[model samples]
Target: MPAPGSAALGVDEPRSASAIVGATVTGHHLLHIDGYSRTKHKLPTGQFIKSLPFSVGGRSWCISYYPNGLRSEYADFVSVFLHLDKSAGEPVKARTKFCLLDRAGKPVPSNTSTTEPYEYLPGGVGFGIAQFISTAFLEKSEYLLDDCFKITCDIIMSEELRTEDRIAASPFVAVPPSDLNRHLGDLLAAQDGADVTFQVAGETFRAHRFLLAARSPVFKAELWGTMKESAATMVSLRIDDMLPQVFKALLHFIYTDSLPEMEGQEEAVMAQRLLEAAVRYGMPRLKLICEDRLCRHLDVRTAATTLVLAEQHNCHGLKEACIEFLKSPRLLEAVVETDGFEHLTKSFPALVKELMCKLAAH
Candidate 1:
């Protein structure tokens, strides 16, 4: 037999799609410093104490905590440094972030410090902030509970830039699709460190503020922007006019970038609600996915409602799909008899007129 996927077999030879991706590996370590008052007096200005070595991105690292600051000029401030503990032949490029934790073990967003990617040479080379926090503020803040506090360091290291071939034919190596979604889904289910809560339709849901802020601008604004919903240590929000299941589905998509499998006629109704939720939350991708589902599930019973939804939400593709489905006179007549038809015609007279014009043109 001829070689598989080869031209000799009267089949076009298979070719691999290749691209150069800048891959990165990330890891974090949290260091708890006990007896902060005792340690603060022991470390003189420009002196420091080191945390136990931790490994991140295959490199050994440690944090140098200077309780009295790194220099006399900054003596009134607490300083922190990230040092490379292991020697390497090539320069390692990495970005670093230091975050101070509250009593709840959540990073205080206002107190977090981040550094740009920097190349570290061999030996014990390090980089960090000299004015991490003011000593007076740390002594008075809630972060200093019983003379103890915690800090977390996150490291993102850049790996070698290389091309990867995604092959359909014979290949020596196989790379599986990313399981980030699975990990994120597990995080949502575990709710181990959820920092925000939502009460929707008498049901409660817990989630992380950072994750929510990262996913949606509306969420980001609500959680951390000028809108500033509330200042409670643990924020609890009451979401009105939304079903619990719809909010749950929206959270699922926010975390996993994919929706849970919904089945049958109820799925279409759920998609419609989810589309509205997506719009409310400023999640365009989710809105688009719901629109696509609505398009596929369009029927005489749902066509009128979906068309009204498409019109209200500015869903061009779904609007076209709805119009196409209503083109048949029998289907249009049946749609007109549906319950939503009255609401559609009354609430959106312009859309009704546009639909009539489209039909007349056709």
Candidate 2:
């Protein structure tokens, strides 16, 4: 049928349909069954009831049930499934919960009473119970209403998206650098214009009165109150008990919230001394660090001393760690022969009793 100068016709454009945008909407979808028992004897292998399709939060979903079970392994139990029919982009995650309805049209009590979350991958991915409940249990169970059982799936949708900025996101910037520690360190380093000094053994350490007062309430009372250290312009506070190195480490901890590593026997010994000094100055964080270090270095040789120190300062963590290390009869027997053991037994007898109680319980 050839025609000269003739043009073919085309259909007109249809009206535009509205599309969703912005943040992914969220909602819960429910799929209910009326006579669940009616499908109880469908097929022994597996069967899907008329696929009840549901659309929620811009995704397609389907609910199905298998009477004799989904797999041979689950043949003794009834199985239910939640399937992702269609998804716009990447896999979407949703939670599904199945229920057995009573005659009152409410959920019946059954072992299948929990929410199951699943990732619906692109193409299709599904999740469900392979062994929900035995058929014998459900058949006689009061869950059936006129031999009708119902199931409800609560579909929870979420906006799981990756924006351009999220692809290479910056780490959280929580705490900005501040002058509190650095400036305090400056006061410790520059000792120029310092107003206070501490004498340990024969060494004199330069310090600031306000710095000590700000750090420790004990120092505040001694440096500014009726104490003799308050009166002098360049105050000299005498501490006869502590060594020069231990006292220096305490000042470092006050300026910088850190401590030296527990390297060897000497540093471990130094840590014990520093912990007591920290306790005297009301530095709980320093004491906690010391406890952690001491716990790591615990041995038959040091366990007795660390336990005594823990008891004296009420450092419960260090005390418990000491007791735990002594759980070995060999270690405990060796610890009893150490010189520190004799000292601890003589000084802190109550701690000995407490250790005995914990070991007995163990």
Candidate 3:
């Protein structure tokens, strides 16, 4: 058995500290083994040495070998190196490099004769490193020492295991209610003088108010009913019941027709507000956004309230989502124990009673 760091037959030691030695030929290629030696030895007739050279901790070494005389010429030559770093307080690194050599002991330059570096971390974990030299560089004899160094740095960083401390914390920090209200005031103030025009169902309407008053089904039925009777005609119906601040936001969306950028906890609130406005104004798209946000952001407590609101306004989708949320066994118990459930049950007695019975069966 070949010892670690020893070269196989017909392989030579690397010429430099950083260079990796690999196979001179690939697959089954017969070649004559003229001679082989490790520490400065001469080769026989057809035999030559191939090696990969690398240095770690201020020490350099190579791995080389000789081929069998009777081996078929189809056998290619390969050199393997085992690198060990013993620097104090430093990581241990190991890698392999390959090269192709001709019968006359010369490197056979080609796309296939490239070197790839692999790494072993401190804890015996292993991974592949990036390619040191590009194929173009090899073909043109353009040395990419600088590129290799850059790649080495990248590999070191890549191999460094990530701890929780290094990872970025969530940007969704909690915001004080005062700050939230202040931000809402600023949003509303920004749209104080804006006018927006939108079509609900089929009728077009214009409003200077920042809030989507048409979102209220009651208001939509009263005002837009005369324009078109078909449900499809309610295309541009605006929502009106959105909170004053939320209405301002909806108005902003109607005019700009773009999402409002927000950060942290504000994102959920803004999304919820926008969804409510969308649902109220008969904006199917915005309603969908709200549904997604409610599903993702609202906790069981808030979801129960949203359920009541949804049912009150005949928002079937929202109601269904709420029902699904409340169906969770753990959450159902929590909901039953809350004052909010009592209010919801009293408000939608039939629906809540039925839901409670269904939950009991589960």
Candidate 4:
């Protein structure tokens, strides 16, 4: 009654390849320990207070807080752990993070610990940091307010399900990554919708006023505020003391939120100049990027110069990196012989004194 290649004969039916659906489930729990001092004095090492059971990734979980350490060897530290309250049919893969909360209940970055994904067997001592924080530090820090403190446990579990749902061997269409930056970069290249013009070192550059104002506070005031330049329909602003190339790069960043590729030696020069421009324009992220670039480029030849830039720009991380690089007596002696060190000593005598003091102590 049923023909071949027909539904009734089952030949026309599509075959489904098995597909495994997987996702990560994330959950966080906050445990507040009141009378922290009493707990530390009363609860001996290896004793813990258990949190109420919570659910994540379709499984029950809880946190174990040890005021004193979990073991006598770690008695000077506080410990935290994540425990799987429910038994699993197979080993579960998960990531765990523990964070000490500040007085405002926000997680302190310096006191957070994150773990890589680990396979957890049921009934085993769950994965966590044994020495989350030293007891001495806890007592001295502002985190322990009114003899109380809080901690947050974040858990991410990888869960998989085997299903019979049919899917194509390959997708019918592949979505591409975002091209917003590319489009904006093209817009900059095309000079379309540009309303502002800048004359820097006898060079002309065109840019959009709204984009510049949106990106930088200094640009906002210069273009949109009560400055005389803001009243013009097509404003022509003259920039003094900046190189045409640096100004061009700054416009590119305003449009694309990224820097163009440059040669190795040119990149360092560009980074230093861009850092100055970033500071002048109140672009904190770009300033940080330049500071990081300069830090990586530090050497005996460039250490003192980088330190001077860092000091003038108030880039603490870069300054510290430069100081660390110049700490060795051999390196210091070599750097002190450079002309950059002469400029640094003349410009930032206080910084030079600080470095000398640190070197003496070392």
Candidate 5:
């Protein structure tokens, strides 16, 4: 016989009295299988029932029942365990319950141990009620039918934590950044098979039409739409308003889908032109990046100019930020002297009125 207070589950698992057991029954999940005797009699103790599926915490889970012992040592008894679906992609920290019921729906709580909570990580340990009723003992009992017995499992994960171990992690395969940028950079740098040319301020930059069409809707329209500008080997664009440095920055963005590194003053200087180009090219993300950079550099000297740029580009966020910045009379007095203030006052006279009212109120 097992020694006094010794566990029959072999590992001497943590008992129900441990505080890690279910603190709150968030919800219950149950499973029952029949035909216990005729089918399970021939199976080995270590065998598991067909994986029963359930879900909690918006994650997948599975339950396993070992009708006989999980090992030869425990073959005389039944074992049941709960397994987390590792394919769910993360560990599930949870508390588990296994219950055995008689035909009368009466409880058999004598030894239906509730396992201490554990994180169900991939390739990690599963939790269970190891010391389920003995096979021989239940064979003659009412719960064992002519050939079957039913088992149920209840899982109520912590609303705060999906698993018991907060730090536990499942095996994972790392995903590195794709080589899209590198390949595109190679294509742009080599220009080995350039199919098109862009003429900006009488300077020509060689590029592939397909690459530009892929990155910008404006380019797509010009290259592939009714315009069909790409049908020619070289397309002349009168981008006289764009500086060569700004155009270079724009091309770097198209090829890399990211900004090129620039010093502080250079970055600020490039922002307005980049934002205008982004809007002209129909790239909202690039426009937003430029808007954010511009916003970070706002000062009395730049506020009025940025306000004009935002209004011209329909950048409501930057416009609002500029208006808020000029709430100070000193700031507004300083901004009104800038070159762009004449344009802002003429374009948005109502905004000037609103600012005057705020200054009077202040």
Candidate 6:
């Protein structure tokens, strides 16, 4: 019983033409319409924006424009606003949820969002923002967006929902540097009954003096037991015997996670000790450091020592590195002159044979 234009203005009765246009054109693709007015005032600039329905993982989503639309200039206007509901619910914030894509349509890591901004040009051809809402939120919430409309609402969410959920549930706990230092100091203080203190890397520990008393077999056995039981006990002790020092260093690292410093040292002696320790303890990092130093400071005698350590430690990698120093023409000639070739042949027959064969072939 209403007037003729009442349906168009929601005051008069139903109109066939308006209903037909509204029914047929519902979709996500940007519609190019000329002179379409929504209200009775007949505004020229107004346009209806709808999103294409996308299905990801069997869930549906409805995307829509923000209330303020492009006028808000919030930089995310072109981006599709997402909601699970087909009816009415407050739309979640989309900026933090949307995946930004690059020119090639590759999803950019979110960290890059801070540095980059997208600009919309004059033509209708421009990138649109796509935001994702979690399925858990959709499942638990009471409200729903209008599912009857097929064009604008598509549910495509990322598989990272589980990871995001875990990250949200657990919070990070920060520890102060001073507290860590205090705890380390307490650990250092606990070993008061020791004599010599040897620090390797940043770790400090105590050592009993008698353990390093030269030629004391009893003390050596006891120290060896301690080394076997807890290799880290040597961090505080300096045993003058190179062999024992190497063994203790290696054992200490194996039992207690610590690395000894390579400062000072009789260069050749320390290199040999460190090399031996590296091999024994299976410390690849320490081994590489020792090998580099030895290579720089190589002499005929040290090369011989390195060769022996390489073989003893079964360090194939270190052996190959040491071979570079030992196979040098100068070092090889020095070995021949010093009658050290015999020692080398005796210790590393395979290497000596290989070197001899290469020399003969050359």
Per-residue error (Å), model 5, residue 85: 16
Model 2's C-alpha root-mean-square deviation from the true structure amounts to 23.9
Clashes of each: 0, 1, 59, 0, 5, 23
What C-alpha lDDT does candidate 4 achieve relative to the native structure? 0.74
lDDT of each: 0.74, 0.65, 0.42, 0.74, 0.66, 0.38
From the highest lDDT down, the ranking of the candidates is 1, 4, 5, 2, 3, 6
Using TM-score as the measure, name the better of candidate 2 and candidate 6.
2
lDDT of 5 by residue, 218-262 (tens): 888777753364464655455667888788888888997767765
Whose lDDT is greatest here? Answer: 1
Write one digit per residue (lDDT tens) for candidate 3, span 1-362. Answer: 11122223333222332222242111111122222222113433223243333443333333333332112231232222233232223333333433333222333222122223333322222222122223333223312232221111111112232343242212233111113334444554564443444454444444433244343453454455434454233333353344555655565555444455554457667776676566555777566655544554556567677777666656676677677777788887887777778787777788777777766776
Residue-level error in angstroms, candidate 1, position 264: 1.9
* Candidate 1 clash figure, as a count: 0
Best by TM-score: 4
How far residue 256's Cα lies from its native spot in candidate 1, in Å, is 0.3
Q: Which model is ahead, 4 or 6, in terms of TM-score? A: 4
- Model 3: lDDT to the true structure: 0.42
Q: What TM-score, to 2 decimals, does candidate 2 have? A: 0.50
Residue by residue across 276-325, what tens digits does model 6's lDDT show? 65554345655665655454455665566566666776667556655665
* Model 2: CA > 4 A from native: 1-183, 226-232
Off by over 4 Å in 1: 1-173, 225-232
lDDT, residue 109, candidate 5: 47
User: In model 5, how large is the Cα lDDT of residue 288?
Assistant: 80
lDDT of 1 by residue, 26-115 (tens): 777887878888778876786777766666656666677888876676699887777665555545666778888877577765467787
Q: Candidate 2 — what's its lDDT?
A: 0.65
TM-score for all models, in order of appearance:
0.53, 0.50, 0.34, 0.55, 0.51, 0.34
